[model samples]
Target: MTLSVSLQHAFPGVSLDVRFDAPQGVTALFGRSGSGKTTVVNAVAGLLRPDQGRITLGDRVLFDAAQRQNLAPHRRRIGYVFQDARLFPHLSVRQNLLYGRWFAPKAARRAEFDRVIEMLGIAALLDRRPGLLSGGEKSRVALGRALLSEPDLLLMDEPLAALDEARKAEILPYLERLRDTFALPILYVSHSPAEVARLATTVVMLEAGQVTIAGPAHEVLADPTGARGFGQREAGALITARVSDRQEDGLTRLDCGAGPLWLPGITAPAGAALRLQILARDVMLARTRPEGISALNILEAEIQDIVAADGDGSAVLVRLQLAPGAGDKTAPEILLARITRRSVSALSLAPGLRVFAVIKSVAVAPGAVGPQAI
Candidate 1:
């Protein structure tokens, strides 16, 4: 269920044009408030008619200006979950969830209602009205409703925007589970980098109505083009890994494509796969292997690429292929590390230079899940 979209539209003063391919996993529409993220998604969902473009999911054509075809919102077979969790106030949670089945074709409604309810942990709220549920609870019910509809594509427009940090935290794991449990493609909209880091499989970056870059989550997130769209401080690398071992001293070890990563205070199972994000500022580089350091995970890597920052400081994004089994560099796993201008100049770093990357345990954030790149 791959989705491809290329669209151009006109607003009062800004023109919107973005083209990107979305994979089967959750594709994040990430940008600031007025960056046309929502506009592109709305066009895909049939809420906004793009002046020109084509949108297709596998074999279904939702929009094609060249063919003069535009499907209405209802007929699009896409379930939309807005920021407000727009559940019916008068209807019980059960009825609100069942409402989703009304639009689903008889043959297409194969998604089990009970399973979705259990997955979302909304079973207890089934008999209660939306008014009685908390913000997080209401959002879960909305998600269950969307799943019950068995949509081909799920469009979530800043679904966590309306909630506070506590409530947002409460719902994130459930969202992660949804991404893993279903085969449905999702176009998730968000301004929060944390949300993108935690949930995105593919990322389509947009600026004031223009597509900046689009690619795999880690690649795009680490690319300077994507990083510049956000502030330099927000620039970072997303790495995929799995929990290989856990220590009793509150440390977790991850087997990443680049190498093993050590993080502090994670409670995941030993075999649980995860995604790890390294903030640009948290990384330090070394020209040669240094002896005696507190850093637990140090990988010998060849610098594949580097990009200077806008002003005084430069952000050198080093692509690393981790030294493989028994300290072997021949079959190393690949990773990215962002170093500053001073370090780049001090070490005279160039592509192909060998360097040791030192990362701190607290620098990595949890809740990242993507396919391994090794």
Candidate 2:
């Protein structure tokens, strides 16, 4: 399934103009507060009508300003999970979930209740009231309710935003399972880069109400240009990798395009495909191979672009392209190096400069590694 949206909303000093394609799996709507990520999602959920826009989910037209077509939220076959779990205060978890099934047309109710319950691990909470559940449990129940309704597309507005770090960690794996099992399109909204990197199959980046970048999670989330769009401190790179071998010392080796990298943890299975994020600040660049370094990764790349951050003596952003001979030419696997202004001038760094991006093993985010290679 695919979602295409071209929406415009105006409210005095604030205006939102978002346009992007959200493919199947999870498409994360990411931006800082007031960047209009929620507005776009609300438009998709039919909670807010765009001043002018067209929204299509597969062949169904959810909204079209020119045609004056707007599907009510109930009729849109879209499920929305707010930051708050919003479960019924008086109802048991089972009853709350049953309420979702009540909204579906008889013939359209195809998602098995048992299946959804299992997928969300909410079976044990069936008899418990919302007040009796933990924060993560409530969110999982909310997700189960949404799935029970048999939605064609799911809209999660920072589902974990209200949870603490421990709660967020508790829920991420269930979400990964949901993403793998469901075929419906999902538009997940969040401001957290770690969450976006962990969950998004596609990323739509917004800035001041406009879409700054949109593409596969790895491509858009990791590109230096794309990272700069998020600001220097947030810029980084991501690579598709998987656990290839696990050492007894708890260090897991991941097979990446550049080479193997060892990181702490052996939770992921061997041969599962995983995506690894290499933060820009954690990377150091060298023109030639450096010796006796404690860092575990050094990917061969060529400088693709160079731009000053802000001030002359502050920092410079260097973009790199990996394996230039790859088959796809649109955008090669890219990496970013954020170096001091002094270093840029010292090396005369310029576009097309061949270099190695050294990444410290410890800097790689935990659970940021993708599934073991398939």
Candidate 3:
């Protein structure tokens, strides 16, 4: 079921007016801090009253200002996860999860207790209190609690923001599992590009309380000027590749839409598909396939588009389409590379011009790699 939201609200210094439809998968509310990501989610969760708006889940109306209808938070059947784990300090982990289940209407209770524990890997910590758990453990329990609520819609407001790098890495896989295993719509608020690349099926880019760009994750991130909302450093594309083999040299081979790519290390076994995020800043373009380059990964590509990089003329972002494989009928695979204006001028880059995308084997971040849905 699609979630449709059109809201108008006002703060002391800023106003919020935006609308979007979230399809069945994870729809990310992504933007910089104070970009109104949280406000939009709050309105949807019935936590914030909008000045005027209409919110609906399929045919069910949660809020309609003109009709004077608004469902209370508990009545909305939505589960929320905040930045902090917020597990109960006085209760054991299992008890805290059951507490969430308690709020779920008996008719709406679909999440099984033991299954949630197993899925989140929290069975071992069932007896521990919040104070005794590590950051990652606490996060898993918090997510389990939300799942146990058996919500039709899940609202996660930067759930990983409070964790350190190690902790964030630990919980990301579980988060991915939640997205893949559950049959619920998720409204996730985040500004991190890596997280969005790995998890978002659809992206709604908010700028100063308005929708700037909204589309599929790959289309939005692969846009030549996508850096408008995601600063240059964070702009990137996500690619799904299946592991073909692990060579004796230690590098792993991945068969992606762009053809075979060799990365430093990939632990997933053969035939396992993985999502990899490639930042525009880490990609380099070559006019021709340079021979004997240090970069082990190179793909033949054709220039698809070009636009100013970072809204400045000093540099440009070139969108490259991988040369399609024989009989391939899927959408063209895209990659973005940031380069100086001089490079574009010297190479005479233009639409339809052939080139090579050169990337180092180690440029891929292991933390950003996650299992792709089959």
Task: Write candidate 2's Cα lDDT for 274-370 as tens digits.
Answer: 7777778888988898899888777788888877654554887788887533343434567777889889888888888888888888888675654
lDDT string, candidate 1, 1-374, tens digits = 88889899999989998898886778998888899988888899999889999999889999999999999998888899999999989999999999998878999777598788888998889899988999999999898888888788999999999999889888998888888878878999998888887888889888899878888887787777787665666667776577888888878788766667888767777777666667766677888876798878776777777776566555556666555546433434455666677777888988888888888776665543333322
Span of ten consecutive residues with least summed lDDT in model 3: 223-232
Q: Which pairs of residues clash in candidate 1, taking residues 3 or more apart in a chain or in different chains?
A: 275-368, 322-333
Query: What lDDT does model 1 reach?
Result: 0.80
lDDT of 3 by residue, 83-170 (tens): 8988889999989999999988888776499888988998889998899999989888888898898888889999988888888888
TM-score of each: 0.92, 0.93, 0.97
Judged by whole-model lDDT over C-alpha atoms, candidate 2 comes out at 0.83
The residue pairs found clashing in candidate 3 are: none
Relative to the true structure, candidate 1 has a C-alpha RMSD (angstroms) of 2.6
Q: Which candidate order results from sorting by lDDT in descending order?
A: 3, 2, 1
Count clashing pairs, candidate 2: 10
- Off-target runs (Cα >4 Å) in candidate 3 are none
Query: By TM-score, is 1 or 3 better?
Result: 3
